[model samples]
Target: MEIDYSQIKVIGFDADDTLWVNETYFRDAEIAFGKLLSEYETINKIDQELFKMEMQNLGIYGYGVKAFMLSMVESAMEISNNNVSIKTIQAILDIGKDMINKPVELLDGVETVLSTLSKKYRLILATKGDLLDQERKLEKSGLTDYFHHIEVLSDKKEKNYSRLLNHLDIKPSEFLMIGNSLKSDVLPLINIKAHAIHVPFHTTWAHEQVTEKETNGKAYKTLSSLKEVLNLIH
Candidate 1:
């Protein structure tokens, strides 16, 4: 279905995978984590249990590398039956630090897209993660000047987006969200009567995956790259 962008006055972008490489590092860290715990369980089992632990602790630790690191430590202890070595725990911390400190690599056309879109509409970053970590990445990304506002949400549920839009004094019909996660970025906006465009990244965390049933009849546009967003909104 064709949608209208004529009413869009504020365009919000998801920071992590949508603007730069994020989940890839997390995947690499997960592989390293599985390798560290290989003695306790198979790599596959370790990966599964780690995901389970992350889901369980999401409420307590929230999102981002720090929370992920805590989940890794807890999962390792449980997997090893409290027999995990201190050395291995140290390795987990090292893995998270490595991820946190990795260079911020922007995806293709990110700067150009932001630069062009910012000139046309008020641009805001709407993303969820560790506040310090997200701020660090934004500082490193060199794209901070393009945004009119930056919001680091705790979660991207329907209520969260509604509250943010309301706080910003933006009407739902006048807001557009662009991101990779259909669950967090697209569906919620669509549910709240806001516009959304999906830009799929090569990798997505398991927690962000959603069932098709939840997306049935959802009205939104999906693009292959951030560059294509210009075609829709302009």
Candidate 2:
């Protein structure tokens, strides 16, 4: 594939799995909390109740450490006959805080790739989730300098992409979104006639990974990793 860098101006990116590890951390915590919840109730019952609440509130709270921690608390209380203690709640909150303050680690080769792309395209981060949580991660990741603009939205859908394009004052055809999550990152961009390069992750968050097969889809391309983006764009 031939890429004309001159034809592209702004490049938008999804934050979580796109640039750094996100859901895996949450999954780990959930499993740990599951062990504790299982001591109080059946594992299957706990999982069902928690999953239902999470799916319901995904849009309202967005993705963040705090909201997830609270979801665990609610799930535990609901399943355990409302016998959850203050200590258990505190422990969950502590875990979430630790994740927030934890040192940010960039995905392998992310720094180098973004550094190369920044020089050629106007880099814009178009991540959608909790504002403060996403902001803290971006700041701590040491990647703030690599992007020209950072956007934190309540959601990433077709309308969000359209608004971003308008704010950038760039035509949809001139921008490209490079990230994981085909549903959120690629399909929305494709809807507006923009280019998208999907970098699939091994384990995607349940909310982010919705299977939609489109073999004949145009305006969107899929790859195995972010490193391939360098080849496609340059």
TM-score of each: 0.99, 0.92
Task: Give the residue spans of candidate 2 off by over 4 A.
Answer: 1-6, 214-219
lDDT of each: 0.96, 0.81
lDDT tens digits by residue: candidate 1, 51-163: 99999999999999999999999999999999999999999999999999999999999999998998889999999999999999999999999999999999999999999
Return the clash pairs for model 1, or none. Answer: none
Candidate 1: worst 10 consecutive residues by lDDT?
Answer: 111-120
- The backbone clash count of each candidate, in order, is 0, 0
State which candidate has the highest TM-score.
Answer: 1
Write one digit per residue (lDDT tens) for candidate 2, span 1-234. Answer: 543445778888888888998877877787778777777877777777877888877766666787787788888788777888888878878778877877777787788889999998889998877788888899889999999999997778889889888987989889988888888888888788788888887787776766456424455677877887887776
